[model samples]
Each structure stands twice: as structure tokens, then as C-alpha cells.
Target: MKEGNDDEIWELRLYVAGQTPKSVQAFANLKKICEEYLAGKYRIEVVDLLDNPQLAQGDQILAVPTLVRKLPPPLKKIIGDLSNTERVLVGLDVRRV
Candidate 1:
């Protein structure tokens, strides 16, 4: 769903190395956040670096558990285990403050 008066869609990309614990946590945290804030309004593309390492170059992802907000221009990237929900929400523009 698009924000009223806005035609932009939220495009998210999560880059992970593998099924590591950190990656798992990141996925869980991200999913929770999306469900709470984005619901059916966003698209999450989880990219496993182990399966396709070359895809990392497209966003210059140098670390695992990186969350990239690709749409609406001025792409934003957050690199961490997604242990901090507030930070992730802020980075993704899903929540403020």
C-alpha cells in the first residue's frame, strides 16, 4: 500500500552471509518490524551472500546482516545484526525517533 498522496513503494534488501545466528536474529527482527510497521506495504528481498556472493557488489555490501532501503531514492543501508529495532526502523524510514 502506498502512503496517501505518494506513489513510492518501500523496497528493502537484506544481505546475509548464511544461516548464522546473527543472520537469523536479523531476519527475525526485521520481520517483526515489518509486520508491525510495514505490514503489506513493503517488499523484503533477503539475499544470501553464500548462495550468490556477487549480488553484494550491487549495493557494496561489505558486511552480513546489512539492511538496505533501496526505494524512494537516496538509498540507505544499515549494517548490523538487527538487534536494535529502533535503529532498524529508523534506518528503513518505517518509524521516526
Candidate 2:
């Protein structure tokens, strides 16, 4: 198994509105995916739009429950509840071993 080094940290930001069902589900799914694939190499920052509406414009987030990969360059964004693990993995460019 190929393990990621401490230097390769995955900076992820999940933008949501309050604690809506979709937001909650997105967070749960993201956490599961990170734990399974990223392990100790990922960091998730949950951004509540309701609390800081201005944050949305910086990322140009048009929808809720959006997951943004900030680190590792070529920033990627996934919009949805993240129910599809395959899609999430692909979108995040995660290679399964």
C-alpha cells in the first residue's frame, strides 16, 4: 500500500448553509471518503454560508454542500450531497489502491 507523506496535505473546504439535511449528508459523506482514502493527509474546513455569506463569493460558490480541494494545485470543486463515492473520488482525483 502506498501511503501519503505528511507533506502532502489535502486542504478541503466544504461550503454549506446552516445544518440542512443535504449539508449534513455532504459533510458525512466527505468525512467518510476522507477517512477511507485520504486518512491523515486531509483537512476539511466546513464553511457555513449562513454564518459568513461573504465567503461564498470568494470561491464563487453557486450552490450549497460544495466541496473544494484547495491544496495540491489545480483546485477542484464538487457540487452536491456527495452521495456518489466514485464520483467524489474521481472529482477529487483520488486513486484507489
Tens-place lDDT digits, model 1, residues 1-97: 2133244667889999989999999888888887776776678899999999999999999889899989856799999988887787777666655
- TM-scores of the candidates are 0.86, 0.91
Candidate 1 Cα deviation (angstroms), residue 45: 0.9
* Candidate 2: residue 97 lDDT (0-100): 29
Query: Across residues 1-97, which tens digit of lDDT does each residue of candidate 2 receive?
Result: 2244547889999999999999999999999999988888889999999999999999999999899999877799999999999898888877542
TM-score leader: 2
Model 1 stretches with alpha carbons more than 4 Å out:
1-7
lDDT of 2 at 32: 94
Candidate 2 stretches with Cα past 4 Å from truth are: 1-6
Output candidate 1 Cα RMSD.
2.6
